[model samples]
Structure formats: C-alpha cells, structure tokens
Target: MSDLSKRRLKLWIRLLGVTRGAENHLRDYLRREHATTLPRFDVMAALWRRRDGVTMSELSRMLLVSNGNATAVVDRLEADGLARREAEDGDRRRIRVRLTPAGLTSFEAMATGHEAEVDAIFDRLSDNDLDTMREILTRAGKAT
Candidate 1:
C-alpha cells in the first residue's frame, strides 16, 4: 500500500477510537448523574429542537434510527410524562411526538450538563485545532 493510503487508514482508526471513547464517557455520565440513558437524551434533544413536534417517521429519519427504535424511546418518555404523542389532525395514523412542559424543563437541565461535559472533554483542543479539525472533517465528508 502507498504511504498516504496507510496514513489515511491509521487516521480512520484513530478517529473511531476517539469517537467511541467520548461516547462511552458521555453514556456513563448520563446514566450515573442523571439516571438517564444516551438514547433517551438523544430523543429529548431532538424533540427540544423541534418544539412543534415531529411524526414518528420524521423523528426516526432525523435520528437516523429505525422507527421501532424511535418508538421505544418515545414510549418511555411518554410513560415518564416527559413527552406526549398526539394524532395529527385528520390523520389518525400519524402521531406527532413532542416534549411536555415537564420534559422541556428536564431536558433543559440535562442539556446544560451535557454541554459542560462535552466542553470539558474537548477542553484540550485549542480554537485553531478545532477549526482545522472541522475543515478536515468537512472535506473528508465531502470526499465520501
């Protein structure tokens, strides 16, 4: 293999390692500190972004997860009174899920902690380093 090809392969592995490490850390943090799972946090985050609500299919698409997976999370949220599912007008088959007031308050608190945790995780990276990484990642994404 060419030198550049070998370097690219190494870079990919390094990226995956870093991503997984960070993910694991966040997962543990959420579970230990908030009594919540990462999937629940993700679902809340998506709902937080779209206050109006989103259909099950739309939510699934936005999260890049299967509808069943999204439904399971939503079910838990609804059971906890953190979210509600309402049928769209004249569309009995389409149920839109949204964060309840309690859910919004809960997510706000969680989001603050989540941001702080993420900031701390990346605290070692300088502004310039972040810029460079973003540029490189954007280019790599385009390449794919």
Candidate 2:
C-alpha cells in the first residue's frame, strides 16, 4: 500500500481503539458507581430526551438495537419501577414506554456522573485539540 493508505489505516485503528477504550471505561464506571449497566443508562437517556415517551419500535430505532433487546431493557426498567408501559391510544397493541418520575430522578443523577466521567476521560485534550478533532471528524462524516 501507498504511504497515504498506510497512514489512513493507522488512523482508523487509533480512532477505534480510543472509542472502545472510552466506552469500556464508562461502562465500568457506571457499573461500579451506580450499580447500573451501560445499556440501561443509554435507554434511560433516550427516554429522558423524549419525555412524552416512545413506542418500543421507536426506542429500538433510536438506540440502534433490536426490538427484542429494547423490549428486554424496558421489561427490566418496568420491573424496577423506573419505566412504565402504556397502550397507545386507539391501539392497544402498540405500547409506549416512558421513564417514571423515579426513573427521571435516577437518570438525572446518573447523567451527572456520566458527564463527569466523560469529561475526565477527555480532560487531556485542550480546547484547540478538541476543535481540531471536531473539524476533522465533521469532514470525515461529510465524506461518508
């Protein structure tokens, strides 16, 4: 391969490594400090964004997970009284899931911790470094 191709390959590997490492750190942090799984946090975050709630299918699409996976998470959340399911109006078969009041409070607490954990992970990057990285990623996203 050409030098440019080799460099690009190395960049891809480095990007993937950084992404995975950060994710792993967040997962561990959430598990240890909050006694919650990352997936649960993610589901709650999505629901938090849409307080009106979302259908199971919509939640699955938002999370980019299988409907079954979304259902499983919702089931656990419902069991814990952190989430609730209500049949959609005029469509009993369509169930909408939303976070309970307790869920919202719980999520807010976890979110605060999550934000700190993420900030700590990227604390090494200066504002200029962040700007440069964002610019590069934006250009790459446009290309894709």
Q: Considering every candidate listed, which one attains the maximal lDDT?
A: 2
Regions of model 2 farther than 4 Å from truth:
none
User: Worst 10-residue stretch by lDDT in candidate 2?
Assistant: 87-96
TM-score of each: 0.98, 0.96
Q: What does candidate 2's lDDT look like per residue over 30-122, in tens digits?
A: 999999999999999999999999999999999999999999999999999999999889688998999999999999999999999999999
Candidate 1 RMSD computed on C-alpha atoms after optimal superposition onto the true structure: 0.7
Collision pairs in model 2? none
How many clashes in each candidate? 0, 0
| lDDT measured at residue 113 in model 1 versus the true structure, 0 to 100 | 94
In candidate 2, position 92 carries an lDDT of 88
Residues 69-136 of candidate 1 have per-residue lDDT tens digits of 99999999999999999989968888899999999999999999999999999999999999999999
lDDT of each: 0.96, 0.97
Candidate 1 local lDDT, residue 74: 98
**What is candidate 1's CA lDDT for residue 134?**
98
